[model samples]
Target: MKKQVVISMLGTQLDQGFGSARWEHWRPTVALGMHEDFLLDRLDLLVDERRYAKLARGVSEDLAQVSPDTQVRRHDTYLPDPWDFEGVYATLHDFLRGYEFLPDEEDYYVHITTGTHVAQICWFLLTESRIFPGRLLQTSPPRKKDESVAGSYAIIDLDLSRYDRIAQRFQQQQLEDRNLLKSGIATRNAAFNRMIEQIEVVATRSKAPMLLMGPTGAGKSQLARRIFELKKLKHQLPGRFVEVNCATLRGDGAMSTLFGHTRGAYTGATSDRAGLLRSAHHGLLFLDEIGELGLDEQAMLLRALEEKRFLPVGGDKEVDSDFQLIAGTNRDLHDAVGAGRFREDLLARLNLWTYRLPGLAERREDIEPNLEFELERWSREQHQRVTFNREARRAFLDFATSTQARWNGNFRDLGASVMRMATLATAGRIQVDQVDDEIGRLQRQWRDVEPPSVLDDLLGGDVAQLDRFDRVQLEEVVRVCMRSTSLSQAGRELFAVSRQQRATTNDADRLRKYLARFGLDWEAMKAARTTSGNS
Candidate 1:
């Protein structure tokens, strides 16, 4: 069995005893040796003042009379004020750091009963931190004069990993926090769920700038706001959250709005202004569409992030405002930096903690939950309940998750589709016919926004050589061909009115000639369509 060692402080007042009556009076250090069940091999006593050397020797001599085998050693740990928490902790920490410990040969215990309350707290901290490499031992005084003078002792182990219930509670709380960051949507997408988990950990632990990148309507703005609310709830931030869309800010107004301006700073300046940065002091500042900001604004923003000081537009004095930054952008900032539209240094600063949110189309598995969420929101705002018929609901979901649905505008499209169907539902019940009509409307909307990238894919760099008129005409023809089954069908749609005026019409031959002019054959166009569908 390993030897038992107790480290304790000498209680100058309580451990006092002299001569013949010392046994009658109950003293803590003397009672320690008188215990029958608890056998200590060695005792390390800490004496704070040099004046207590004689008293410490007397106590050692008294302990010898009760238990001669137990060895007592005195350490001079001089503390000017034992009541000072910082001073006592530093003193104890230094002593523990230098002390030799043999974990295999000895089991150590720290006696907290003899020290002052501050010293007790320090001992607890040191023991809990494993700096002392021991468990805490607390002893209480006897209640009655006839009771045994050894009193009662309890051992406290500070290692919390051994307790399962406490660990589970901490894990459960972390899950709840992650859910709050996601607005409690119960999303089914595995990748999106994992991303939210990391965001929660970073948002709570760090005050550094974060970059949120995604396409439009992909929930960057909403996520930024949720992060701000979570931090504020944790009491990590004290001021209010300030948000601004960089795309809406222009020219001199952008500078004035972000960094504030002094009275008579510009032509329209009437009074002093506290900018968004100042308003967000001790809080969070979310700059949406950050890539849209000018080069000058980017430079100023870098200064504000590195050193919490900046001068306002036309101001002579520098202002101080310390705030956490969260910047959101739909554009690729690396490309913008290369084009000289955005500063590279600003991108570097924001790139430390970057998270890219997926568009709605990529998270198709989460569409059902988000659909339910949007309907609930609509009901809460409009103050009226709406339900979908079984058939209508199935039809809408099938179409929403289908390959035909582009969802180019991401969650914005889903929200708007739900609102349109809800508004048109008769007596709060949406029918199958309404779902069909909504699907057609969505197809039309997507077609209207289809970019010229269709032609770019087919012709590569050759599309750039064509005039604006040719590019538009060819893009439409290519789209019709990809949707049609054959060249003849595509020609009939493209030349619908014009072909009727002709005496003879061979639609396939006409389309073949158009394809030949652009050096694109029918087989190549069909192959590209097949590849696009599989992707």
Candidate 2:
């Protein structure tokens, strides 16, 4: 079998004393001795090029008595500062890369007996990381009575997991990190918790474009902001958080506001303005409702997202903004792409690392905890802490999480509900009666705007006969009638659109006739409303 090869750096001052009989001191190398003494087949000594000749000569002369058959080779290694980690690591890494050794043919050992303190750490790091495929050999000085041999040595083969204490510490840290990302919200939601755990890992490790897709008021914006804050705390982000609601931006204003504009770009050209993109340089750019951006703006936005550069509205030169993006959209971008409203390429670019946030209705179990959070916020903002009576709290939660409760606006609606209860609290306490009143108010408000879910029951068998458009319009009409205390009020609201087209609009007559076509008149509508409220 081939002999074991030992790779080590030459000890600077020790080179003089190594096996030097004139000095009357034992050599660390001689103390280590040769192959048979330490089980080393060959020694690959990495030495300072300036002292190569003397070191090589000394080593060879010493090896004659230690182990004659053990071959010693000297390498002229350059390290200006043995204490500098980069200098030592780079030199060793480059040297190892040039060498090709078959592990099956020979065993390799890294002698940690000779380098500087920093060099020793680099060796451990490199070897442990498998950059240097070898076991570490650390040699200690000989005892007083033992003059026959050099020193005692220990072979260390690294298996990180075998270090139980370190492994346990890592596991504990991971759990803490996960909880931090979750904002310490101990939720019972399994899927949401898993998603939060994944998001924590991604936020901690990567700086990639993230897409937060969900319905309106589903906490996408909040989650994006939380991710930014987490990254900021970790020192991964050093810039500000720039947020823009794409829905509020339109026309030339949208272009100028997003990509900046040169002087004299538009009618309101007073001075050149650095747009939101420029403001988000080296920061996070949250484009909420990104789907609402115009197609022209979409093309420009896409270019900026991919190349980090875009031309101003009326400029010849391109401006650069190096920013990470967190895009939130409630719209179905795929459907928009199909309709030629959104670009497919832009969608593809933003689709990577997409996370879908579930709407509030989907995670009703979390509502109760969030209710407490909202109440706390209300106390901070309004300067009055409020608590609900046990019975009232239970009653409100039952109604809030029920199938009948259409949380159409998601968390926003819930927040509003909590706010109203907190504000109307007498002496900072919400009673059972207050809960009943709020539930009824919410029910009525939701029913008035709610999508027609019971079209079959309202129209009976006739629902199947009507086209989808007519069904939608009729549902709106019926829902309005159910909400209105008077037919004329419902008429006025429903036909407000058509009244603009004509000077005289008989909205009441038009609504009455439309209801007649569906075999439903004014009295039938009131009866249906009564039935709905009772049910």
Candidate 3:
């Protein structure tokens, strides 16, 4: 005869101390087999003897109209408590000792019908303790009212041939979920799409360290997450993604934080701690602002990368961690190297899969879509729905185009601008006036100083040969004066004689007429005399 499978009905009240009473009230009824209409026929209801009588009475009283055999067995005989693993296993061992329920090295199954964490833990312990039947079955809680509460089950066949493959598949599914959650912000733009594709390829195809270069707010971290997600989705990695801002990793704290330290590693190192690298073992480690890392830390990082080995800050033993690296920075690594601030060898390692993200201004086409997305997000966050007026849209475009704003702050600035406008509008629509005003305010805030002009340039030149003329004519006169130093000297030198050649017809008026024709006057000449005594 085939060995009988033992199906255990384990029920416990969910913790209600945290104030989830609604989910707790139905628990006692469920435990008492009051919902027998919900269970399958083959399951055995196990309960403590003292509670069994009360549960049996309640079930018999309330569920008398249901089938007779559906009632749970109520015996006054004492059974060892199953709250602890040792006690539970002893009880089960005695109950199934010489029975056909025990499988002959195979065939029998142990099915657990409970969703509580304690039950899951107990089940795991039972398997580990070698008391569980050949196969383990688990059921998930019903998701809908019409769905059967008989529970969804899984058979952990754990056949040696397929165990590795099954475990890998399970881990892969978990990683995919994590990646999806973390990469929700990434979009399908050409740049981002290309970035994602490269990330996917790197995660699966290459083991090279990746460097994400971009200005602040250009989504370097987000891109890193996308890469992680793609890898996770492809099941190429089984490690958790750990992020660390090198800016925060400082001084003595750096060693302890990155590579971990043993208990009493330092004065205050009370207990052993696993550093971020170890925590990210078999995973991705994202280092943001990696350029901020000190030379010593850089050496440590280089060592880690080179050998996949590092000693904890205060610990003598070197631990091994094999993690894919993704670093991000707004600084120019090459410039840093040239300036003797970064190690060239370390940079060489990081250069293998580097990508520079385009700034907001460089990708103008993406601005509107990013704006719309941010506005919608802001509106949702503010608990309001807002629409952009046509003029508002035009005004935003105009403002964006009119200035050479670095948009170094990128999407963050845009999001903040939209949020501020939404707050100001309060109404359903964002007016063009508000956008214009906000842009004007930002321009004033970040406005560049105007450079000195050509006029200033000229004024700054030599003033030794300056001329007297109306401000309007000063420039031209100065040019002429620069060529010829004195006005009287220029007249005499250019016009042949100082006064004029003597006229044969010696009329003073005729001489004056001749002088006037040359843009000179007898009065101006007398003034030039300035009395012989002064000369």
Candidate 4:
């Protein structure tokens, strides 16, 4: 069985002889019935010098008579006043600094019954902070109605979340934290919402390197800024946020820009200069497109991250900067490591908390909300309000969600589209004609980027005889037909003007014969296109 050990403040007044047996009846009543009712292997008493000076010896002697086997050791602790918060805290805090607990051999507890309210509060703080490492035991005197036995006692833990109110406050704090990360943008995407909640938790607790991976314009930079803002609000960082896009930095100058340079370090280095890393001291450093950094730079960066110090370019002495790293990359770091382009160790360090944000295409459900967000931004920037007409809003949303619209540029495209329409809107209202004009412009821009003919493969050498005009037309015809659900829909679009004029329009027959002219059919052309895409 593990031995029981009790730590308490010396009950100076309770130890004096008051009545025939009244002294033995004192609460915490350590002098009487200790071995009988309150059994313990050892009793560690905290004795206040001035308060217990006269009665300290008598207190120890009286305890030995009743609890002979219990080893009582008294520590000389001094406090100006038992009720003074600072005095009691300093005395107890210093006592615990040198005190040792043998957890393997004994079960221990703190007896809080004898101390003043201030002392009790200090004890509770120490225990909750884990400096005490023991449960608190409170004792009381016997009640007048039931004086047959000793007083009652209860053990109270300081884990506040066990109570309903504290837990509710914690939940409210979490909701507020989520709003901070979202930047007040209301979104319904389940995956994105979950990611925001997780980021909130990680940002508040950790300062470790974090990696944000996603496609371009997928809000990685935006999220990094939000994190910096939140941390700053929480007083977690004292320095400014320093951001560098590695993809835009080139050659040897990139090194000096990131790690600073000393005088006479290089031909262009005329004077000593501090770099972005130093600027991020005691703050956050956001490295966007980190995979674009050179091998030499990557090696030095890894060293700085590991040691919290690094030698700058052309400098012999090392400089130190304690900064949190948040790296953003669109590339697959694992693939880069496998290809020997990225360091495995650096990847491992940054991979601690990786969050992959989905692109606009993946979160198409969010387009409507973001569309309104863009309009609101335009309103702020231009100092004028812009509202989409009912018909225009429906038309734009339909096109944005259609299969024909590939949001290749993700949020970038959406923002630009809203900006153009807002700019063209007459008298702060985006009409249907403005939406149509923007859609047409976007289609032409997208059409120019389409690849060269898949026709040469399917149509053989006959494809060579066709001019650029016929070639572009045939490619569009084939692509639209493959995507369409039925031949009639494809025919209606291909011959929109002429089919509308004819009294009895044979749309599918026209489309079939049009395919026959190229010596190809719908099913065969779709199969060949799929094969080409795979290759």
- Estimate TM-scores for all models: 0.76, 0.69, 0.49, 0.64
Tens-digit lDDT string for candidate 3 (465-512): 334333335444333333443454444444445346645323444444
- The C-alpha lDDT values of all candidates are 0.91, 0.83, 0.64, 0.84
Q: Which scores higher on TM-score, 1 or 4?
A: 1
Q: Candidate 4: worst 10 consecutive residues by lDDT?
A: 27-36
> Which is the leading candidate under lDDT?
1
**Cand. 3 TM to true fold:** 0.49
lDDT of 2 by residue, 381-405 (tens): 9887799989989999999888768
Candidate 4 deviant stretches above 4 angstroms: 1-165, 450-535
- Error at 490, model 3, angstroms: 44
Ranking by TM-score: 1, 2, 4, 3
Over 377-407, each residue of candidate 4 has an lDDT whose tens digit, in order, gives 9899999999998999999999987755767
Top candidate (TM-score): 1
Q: How high is the lDDT of residue 222 in model 1?
A: 93
Q: After superposition, how far is residue 444 of candidate 4 from its true place, in Å?
A: 3.0
TM-score preference between candidates 2 and 4, better one: 2
- Cα miss at 261, model 1 (Å)? 1.0
Clashing pairs for model 3 are none
Q: Across residues 321-378, which tens digit of lDDT does each residue of candidate 1 receive?
A: 9999999999999989888888999999999999999999889998999999998899
Clashing pairs in 1: none
